[model samples]
Target: MRTLLVSLLSISCLHAIDHGPYIQWFQDPCHEAEIRWVDRSGFQAKEGEWSRGRGGFGYGDNDDQTVLNGMQNKYTIVSIRKKITLAAPANADDELIVEALYDDGFVLYIDGKEVLRKNSTGADAELEAPGGHEAKAWEKFSLGKIASSLKTGSIVAMQGVNDKLDSSDFSLDIRLSIKGKTSTDLITRSDSWEYLVNQIPEKDWRTSTSLPDAVPWKADAQYTLGYRPVGNGEMTWTSANSHLFARTESKVFSVSLKGLKADTRYEFSIRNESTKEISGPHLMQTAPETFRPMHFVIGGDMFHTLPLLDAMNIRCGQEAPLFAALIGDHAYTNNGNPDRWYQWIDSWVTHCRAKDGRLIPMVMGIGNHEVAGGGFFPENNTPTPDKADEFYTLFRMSSEGSRVISRYAVDFGNYLSFILLDSGHTEAISRQVPFLAQSSANRKKTPFLFAAYHRPAWGSGCKDDAVDIQQKWCPIFEKNGVDAVFEHDHHTYKRTWPLTAGKRDDANGIPYLGDGAWGVAVRNPSKAELQKRPWIAKQAPINHLIRVTLAKDGFTCDALTADGKTFDSGTYPLRK
Candidate 1:
């Protein structure tokens, strides 16, 4: 079967295409990049005795460059520049099969930005300073997986391959292969429609505009711990809920812990592990074990709109709720650049200051923009589960062993359970049924139930609704006697009367609120339509965050405008 598959691929193969070993060399071994221009002369500058080009260069003990630091020569560092020009931007899903064969640690920079590394630890200077051999063999990597924005035209890529100023051997070999200057809509799923890749300008953390420093917000129960450290490092954290207080030699962080004490507070932080440099002694309080009034902010479509995110953050901070549940579109972080997501998140962490000093916890759900197909980072105008794993690496949602942290339940207290749904960005609607049914069925006497997902089952903007969700999850919600269902995606805002089987039924139907307007622009419902249609309880075209207050027997929710004024409100009565 495998042979047959290969034969079919070979038979249907249209062509084999790849471009460029484009090259140039610099001798400075940039200690720092900005304000250190050597000019683009296409030749070597003679400062002392340094040069460029390919060669079997080796140094003996005491060579000036090698011994410059005990170091011999001054040009121990050199950069190979490859100016790859694409007639058209490569497809977002397209990958340049980078072939790298080198000695010592090296750093790669695309255009001028340093994309998150490949199998590397530490910073570029350290990597460029020397000591990497694992990638010495020809190893293939993908460019799209590293860069956030890859577009048409010329791209200047450079890599600094290092050897200790006194090392015996050093070499540099790198290349990129992809469907260059061509369009290829990346497929979203095996049977789903395709979409385009995002083509915004790339951001260089070194120079990209940064927000003024605000108080940093700590990670919550569902927070993502960056990456597992490579070599010797400590992964340290503490959880009052779980009675956890320890440091591990290995730096692999986890999220969504079990056995945590309800209603207790926990303190945690992220460190360099090696440096013991800490991010926080910040605190996060767990949901209470008993029923009580709880406050939380709900919003979505936060597509890098810093001001909107800022307003929401500050507003939520002022409200100082138990947590913030963001439905989706946190940031349009494409090309596997987790930093893109973190940077936007950083904006919130810093600016979203509470009246009191406490880290606001977060509950998250992935939207279409968050995924490739759902809309956000479409490559070659395509979407793919192929690279959506990047989202998972940064967040640890409630899904225990699932790649898509789209669905799961978080207990707010004995009385309320937020059952989060994965609206088929990467996972199928059908596949989520088992989990939905299971979570809905086992309520543990928690009468107040709320549900959240990205796309609304009934919206007023685009398509007005999602049949997939209506069919797949609505029945389950109804069976479970859900108090209210929160959803976002259409960028418009609307609340439906209690709905059951797609129609408004006041007696036993589930109410649907939110068409999602957190950071994205507003698409208010047509005013005429609002009057003509009675199914919609209320509708508005504005950027607002919803606030929900839950008590033992009931709950109240209100949509608050950017400046923190209530525009829409609803109350769900006690469950029978």
Candidate 2:
């Protein structure tokens, strides 16, 4: 009975994982469809007319599983259909929830019946997609009491429309989930083995990725020790099942361990069931929950120049900071190429470590190059989350579940806080202001308050400031007493004299500490170029990371090169 129950539980757990496929068809501009028939059951697409891929289908957004080739200038619509074959009929009280990540407009149909419409017009065959829409995070719509409509073989179809045929990008993807009695998620952890071995020494897990089935682990765990590293690892962990949180992307999974003491260190390991391979017994420490003495590394624009980045990564690891704030421009993988990310992660996993061998937890913000169609930020246009799909998937902290809201705040036990902003990559700069204001205001009392983003509002390399950021967010930082602001993307080193209202005011100014020259080719501005920008207190064409230490009295920052040389240092007292 026990064996059968375990087997059944394992099957149930596997079935609950939601990484499935959908059939997609990008509309042809030369011969557009005059009728919409794919939404109905038994509607078979003509041979070679449709392609199958995971959710998220579209063009130019790099993250799309099914790229609508040549659709940017030729067509403005793509239709996606998924067949739901539930094992049994849904209960009358069961709730059906549909989550969608879309851009411009879309119309949803269930078994050929119109169900929901968003930013779109017309009906069935005449559906029109006028441009000028920005895709945000996942939006949820409820099909209340429509349990009977969810019968087996029913087709859930969506037509994703672009605002214009020449628009920069378009995307649409969805998930149909049911919630009700007997719909409990299978919470059981699998991959069980009898004996627990701690044989493998702590090494970078990227080698584990080479193990055919080895899943690369990110530094996102909170505390609980016993856990499975995504991709079918043994569940012979010591912690209870309740503490394990499973996150899935395609077939690979990431298990987050929760409910552990803060600022404490723990050892963990994973065993591969397929190869009988043992890996880890590695160390990870939870972020501090209270104020004492702590330090962290901060920089951005990495991976373009490999050797420089690797050097900086090694030097950063030696700092033994609590974490590294690698804001943006990672890999320069402009169009969602997996190989670019693979190399970047490999280097990070190998070199970005603490002196004591702890993998440095990374906190990041999105940048222009992260988008699929690189540097598409027009003053009036907004991009979608689909543009930077890999960034969200590659880093756990940058997103909430599968939904990536690019702006978020992380607080450390009332003493320190970081407000990470997305500088018009996945979200608009204006839209982030309210969040920036609220986050800054809430952290006013924090002993060490900092804001980090990819673009510099007042840049020395660039001709002008990010007008939107300067007009909207800089005031909030000054008003809320932010001690410092870390800015990046110019490929040069910079430190500004504390300024308020666009001028130096040492008594009431927030220091802008970076122009982001981590691993990218440094931009050397001559004295003539330097003389053009009066906001700079110090500027150099050098690659370095800022190491900051916080104490009860105040904090200090040191700019260090990859070879471990401190070229610049400053001490700042807490703002009262």
Candidate 3:
């Protein structure tokens, strides 16, 4: 009786484990499917199974006897057929998380390293077993790892093994999510180059193509190339002599130009391709031969408020920086629709043009709002099918169709490198921890370093509660000598005193800035909470934007509120 009860319990567990949705099967080892099966005995069935009663059941009865009276024992190998395609920006740090449910056991591999292993058994086994011999089952296992080192077009795969005696009765289910660097690297030297330029009318510019000149600039005119000499500085344009045409859908136009120097600087201007409305009286410097100073804007949690965008536009215009880094929460809610995203893009394109009419480039990191609303509890929500399919497509990144190479380093004169990380709505921080450690070594090339993400590591505001950042990401930052970290999420202004491990506020420690106040309302941090956390250097109830100016002496950071008030200013000296 005791033996029978034990067997019954085992069978019951197996049955429970097997009772979930079915994942497709795959034959290629590199495919991103969750289940795979190989049949050894040549027994064929739509689904697989064998009946114990067919051969008459008895204590310790062998189901093989029924199959082998004149036949041979059969084994069915099952595997997942679906694949996970990671969308990562070129050269950016990223991670991939794969979750699967299967019968028996599973082995996960990324670039062929076994990352996770799991086995399941029980009374439920009988219920899931083929013909009631001894069923095998497993369910829901998660595996995560950094994708930074992965090459473009690399494949990720998962394999499952079941010890069932029959060639039939196999099942599995699998899903995947990725975070970080969804945009492809646009600065690479290649022939197939597409340019998206913004042409504001009255802003003198010239173009290669002659279309019925759109909104901003007119068509067909003799545009002049303006120049001025200042000090010993040489004027150069990063992009010049490009074909220009306005984009019908978006507010920006595109220019494609070639025949220029590599790692060299030249100044050029654009006039209406047709109207000859010369748009540039300004100058841009090209990438350096080695390492040069690269500048970009960082902020997040912006709702579709035009006023906030206007402020940012004005500041950015005055600053006239290179790129913009948005730490997620782009649209109000739901990553399902493209309307909000498009609107946001249109607004930026319209207002944030350079003096020469170039639309500022954008690099985005995922946020809770970019995924399914709140990011902490992600399992309950699945990406809407169509939206999920289109999300990566709209963004110009190598995050689709088996590409690897997430997490990019923008080398600004080999002295400063900005590492953009993804911290929400996808994989957990733990997976990318190792990559963060490795990134520290880059300080040798770029002595000044910083990291940007969507969520804050430390917070004093009531809404600033992100446990994952404190636990998983903080240590990496501290260990890496990351000069500072910029984060968004909470809608107020706060800065951390160079901190180590959330508490020790050492001058050498990593400082954290932000709580995303782009367009969001501000909430003050209480005195009691502020007192408890000494790492907070300054906390205020204001909506603001941060600007960093890098020079040979040191870098200066200014936190300016929307109304152009300089709330805080600090400088980070270059490390010896």
What TM-score against the true fold does each predicted structure earn? 0.58, 0.58, 0.50
Query: Weakest 10 consecutive residues, lDDT, candidate 3?
Result: 50-59
Better candidate number, 1 or 2, judged by TM-score: 2
Candidate 3 structure quality by residue, lDDT tens digits, 38-106: 111111111222111111101111211011211113332332111123354333345555545444455
Q: After superposition, how far is residue 543 of candidate 2 from its true place, in Å?
A: 0.6
Best by TM-score: 2
lDDT for 559 in candidate 1 is: 89
Worst 10 residues of 2 by lDDT: 33-42
Assess the local accuracy of residue 270 in candidate 3 as a C-alpha lDDT between 0 and 100: 38
Residue-pair clashes per prediction, in order, are 37, 2, 75
- Candidate-wise lDDT, in order: 0.52, 0.63, 0.46
lDDT of 1: 0.52
Q: Order the candidates by TM-score, highest first — what do you get?
A: 2, 1, 3
Off by over 4 Å in 1: 1-259, 334-339, 376-386, 398-405, 527-533
